[model samples]
Target: MFKILIIEDDLKMREIILENIHRWGFDGLYVKDFNQVFNEFINYEPHLILLDINLPSYDGFYWCGKIREVSKVPIIFISSRNSNMDIVMAINMGGDDFVQKPFSLEVLMAKINALLRRTYDYMSTEANVIEHRNLILNLKDSTVSYNDKKVELTKNEFKILYVLMKDKGSIISRDSIMRSLWEDENFVDDNTLTVNINRLRKKLEDLDIENYIQTKKGQGYIII
Candidate 1:
């Protein structure tokens, strides 16, 4: 089943959209914190997104730009304002389609299914390979390894390690890690990050890497 993400601010609208998603036997996630939309997006890993224009803290345009930086997921604009400027901006901002307010739910789902089929049905796959230090990240399967031994991790652990390894020698704050894993089933908190990191450290120790991850008090973490 295709997973859909709703990035609307209106609680009622989000609720109705989610209902349609369930009716179609698909997984759907609603964004609760506008400030951390990207984190939620990655964790949910939706096939497509329904993004509204006006939002708290920042507009949908800002968030759309951020998502584009990391993913090529399909986006549809659901806005009340049908101004020419709005439609132009939505298309220019990477939206696959725009649905004016008061749109029929049936039409919305049709657009969604059509987009998903077009994007994923015959799309080429990209490998997810990342390397740093003695660690190699296998993007294809979300696996990590040092030398010839593989490191098995929970989903959160893999994400934490991936982010850290991607920026090796740079300090990554707890807040940053939280953002990367926030879309996970269990909302990631600061303490949860610490626990996951420690677990990863223990696993690494078995492979002869002692204290590989450096901790900076009141700042962040780094793998030196």
Candidate 2:
């Protein structure tokens, strides 16, 4: 079953859309925390997204750009705004399609099905990228890029970053990080882990990103 994430803020409209989506035989998911939309996107891994323009904190356009930094998942903008500029901006900002508000559910579902078929039919694989605070980590290449400048990471550095960034808001313990390195056959002791972390921090600082990783005394490390 393909999962569809609905990012609409209107209570009635969001519920209606979700009900219709389930009626059409697709798994429907909605965002409970608007501030954590990106995090929910990562957790849900939806096949497609239905996004609204006006939202609580940052608008849909900002979230769309953030998601585009990581994945090419199909996005369809749903809004009451019908100006040509709005539609143009939606597409320009990486949205696959647009649906004006007070639209027929049938039309919306039709567009959804068409986009799903067009996008997933020919695409074989998805890019493995993680983005936080405008910093992008490309897992395939073991490199980190910030503000257009890129830096290569050693195997240990890449693994450590990956583990932390994968769970960005949570603190990862020293022992847990060592186990991750051990699983990768890196054989890292406490001192070695500390050395790798310092090196990674230096590289991030070189990219003008200070305090990208934070140390929590008596606990562990976290990227926030």
Candidate 3:
């Protein structure tokens, strides 16, 4: 199943698009936090993206450029704005196509199918991988590896590592980590996050990476 990432901020519209996508036999993932769009995108490694123009903090055009920096994954801009300038800017910012709002689910599916065919047919399925200090985090496979050693990680472990390494030098607060893990505000206790971090740390230790994840007293965690 091809994975499609939806970046629309409107909850109702996002749900509508996701429901249609599932009915059409495609996997759909929605962005939970607008501020972490790029990080979520990298973690999901979707085959295509459905982005909107109006968003919180930063607009879709900004995110389109950010996604372009890392991957050539197909991006289709979906927004209510249909002005010529908006259309032209979308294309210039590395968007594969643009679909105005009030679009039919049928048409959206057709566009998605065409893009997937054109992009993936005979194209290399390159693993979505990120590296920091010689430790490779393969997002596609949910594994981490170092020289002559490899370790598989659970979903939580992979997500925690992704956030830490993606930022690398900066300290990520505990609240931020929990939000990344459970965006719905579900009750994931403080101990849960600590346990997950400890487990992840041990895995790194197994790969001969000692103190790879450091704790910032009274702040949070950092990987430098």
For all candidates in order, the CA lDDT equals: 0.82, 0.89, 0.89
lDDT of candidate 3 vs native? Answer: 0.89
lDDT of 3 by residue, 1-224 (tens): 58999999899999999998886557999998999999999899999999999999999999999999989999999999999999999999999999998998767877887788778852145448989899999977899999989999998898899889888999988867865565222445689999999999999999999999999988999999
TM-score of 3: 0.55
How displaced is residue 170 in candidate 2, in Å?
41
Each candidate: RMSD: 12.9, 16.3, 13.3
TM-score per candidate, in order? 0.55, 0.54, 0.55
Clashes of each: 1, 0, 0
| Candidates by lDDT, descending order | 3, 2, 1
Candidate 3: segments with Cα more than 4 A from true spot: 122-224
For 69-100, candidate 1 gives per-residue lDDT tens digits of 88999999999989999999988988899999
Task: State the lDDT of candidate 2 residue by residue for 64-90, as single tens digits.
Answer: 999999999999999999999999999
